[model samples]
Target: MKLRIAILGTRGIPNNYGGFEHISEYVSEGLVKKGHSVAVYNSHNHSYTASNWNGVDIVHCYDPEYLLGAAGQFAYDFNCIMDARKRKFDVVLIMGYTSSSIWGMLYPKNSAIITNMDGLEWKRSKYSKPVQRFLKYAEKLAVKYSGSYISDSRVIKTYLKDKYAIDSRYIPYGADLFTDFEREQFDQSALLKEDYFLLMARMEPENNIETILEGFSSSTSHKKFKVLGDTGNRFGKFITHKFKKDDRIQFKGPIFDNAAVRSLQNNSYLYFHGHSVGGTNPSLLEAMASEALIAAHDNPFNKSVLNADAFYFNNAAEVRHLVENVQRHDTEKTMVQNNLQKIQYQFNWEKVINEYEEFILECHKKNIHEKVIPGNR
Candidate 1:
């Protein structure tokens, strides 16, 4: 069935931002290709200047986020919801609750609100105690307001089902198999390819970036360790300062260009995924797609995706053990290849998008099927 979909949240398209933007780019474009109407909201400050991208309409909303700090996200979400209400979309898919839940009441009743409850946001170590408390409340509001929920991980699906007693649609993020990339794009230092290990993540405490770096530093391995993503935040600054003296660690700040990221992933001897909280990280899937030997953070979320086909590490010691004795682990290459096969079978972009489409259609159909019998006449 054809549907008019409005995707809210994120800085929007062609995905220079993060995973949410990446998901929006693929889903909006894919839905358009499937003969459905798709509109994605972009921040006025977004890099892509165009009003449309690959047949998907882009609506620019004024984002004063830089000046106002966190308050600006609320403003952006309210503006998007206001615009969306006017459009009268069949399905309005909200990527993450965050600020959106604050403006949930403004979302049009005509639209079927489907929210992606991103990880356990309040549980992140990044947020202040009060902010975390607010997020916990926001989670409740989001669950109450949305017609349905979309979980990016099975672990999350089970969380929502068990906590709120609602069956959230399970549709994880997808990544393109990096069979081709600009091989020369990587910095000369990180150009060692299979000799160096890679750790690409937002330098946050909850992500265990420091833990991974600590382990890598402690190891006697002669290979260089390549680190990506920006160190602009306070946490980032602290991390950089802590690891600055290490000549073996190359801090390639925020390589947003997809080709460069793919090149780094494809060439890296090992990919270190330290995200301990997030649900089914896109980078992890992309690493699997790139056929990198993965050393993922040991957690229920990561375990659900990587299963027994990964070198799981719970702390600095475990990571160090893995690094120091990687050669002793003869099954590392076999596990890496198995992860690649998992991407082919389970995490294919086409399959992910098709599932998303089906879920969107299902939400729309349920909303339409709601019957109101005449009462108290």
Candidate 2:
């Protein structure tokens, strides 16, 4: 069941960005390995300029997001859709509908459109009421226009079913179980010997970045608290301005090197995941793969993955309590082992790719079959 698939709605491959880019990179390469012809759309400003990556074709499309601000993404999607119209792919996989979902109707005919309805973007606190309304409408359009849907978390799958009655395929992101790190590399990082805590997230209001920082500030521990993200937004500015005097907190700008980030995660005494808006976050999965003692925000999405392997935090008070009383749990060894096993067995890359491959083939066949049958739509 080989497929000709096109993945859209991401910045590009090489995974320098967030979850959508990572999914495009892995899915494209993985499907190609399974004898499918996969093409991933890349923004004109993407770092990778090659025509091909890991045996998957790369299609560069015009993107204006760098200059036009948020509006540029819709323009970029329009260009990609126009280009895809000519190619006539068997299946088109759209990673997210942040902007493109509104134009779902513009998507070319003769292709099965399968969209990954990302976490509830409309519910984020960052968006204004009007913007959130638009996002909700976009979600409806995306679900209505797409032939099928994919959800990266079961919590999300349930949301789609309950909210829109759409039966989306459940497919979470996968992580590599990383055990290879150089002692020299870890030593050179100048980090405390598995004593300090670490957090890696986009400096956004909805991600509860300030809550994490405030919690660390409230703690009496002497160990350093390191945060890895660029404070380039207004929300980030507020957090830094408020926490500037905290001597124990350290803000390291964004680190793109996966190996360096992995080393940091693997050696941390505890990794704090504050993102409450996304399902099965890539950073959380990386933390799990690194087998770090996890402290994630207490949300159904986070709980669905971490389960008992993590110590949950709802507010700064809970985070403070978890931080100050970390030793009493005595579950690091058991928790680490449990998380590692989950990554190896459930979130493994092999299983993820197989699921994606099988779903794409199913969509492809059903699409072809629907063309011959009347009233199937």
Q: Write the per-residue lDDT of candidate 2 for residues 46-142, one digit (tens) a residue.
A: 9899999999899999999999999999999999999999997999999888889888878978998999999999989999999999999998999
Q: What TM-score, over all chains together, does every model reach?
A: 0.95, 0.97
How close to the true structure is residue 42 of candidate 1, measured as C-alpha lDDT?
A: 95
**Candidate models: Cα lDDT each:** 0.88, 0.88
Candidate 1: where is the Cα deviation over 4 Å? Answer: 180-190, 328-330, 371-377
Candidate No. with top TM-score: 2
The alpha-carbon RMSD values of the candidates against the true structure, listed in the order shown, are 2.3, 1.5
Model 1, 123-220: lDDT tens digits are 99999999999999999999989988999999999999899999998899888777533555555474665888998888789989999999999989
Clash-forming residue pairs, model 2: none
Which segments of candidate 2 are over 4 A away from where they belong?
Answer: 181-189, 328-330
Where's the lowest-lDDT run of ten residues in candidate 2? 180-189
Q: List the residue pairs that clash in candidate 1.
A: none
For each predicted model, how many residue pairs clash, with residues at least 3 apart or on different chains? 0, 0
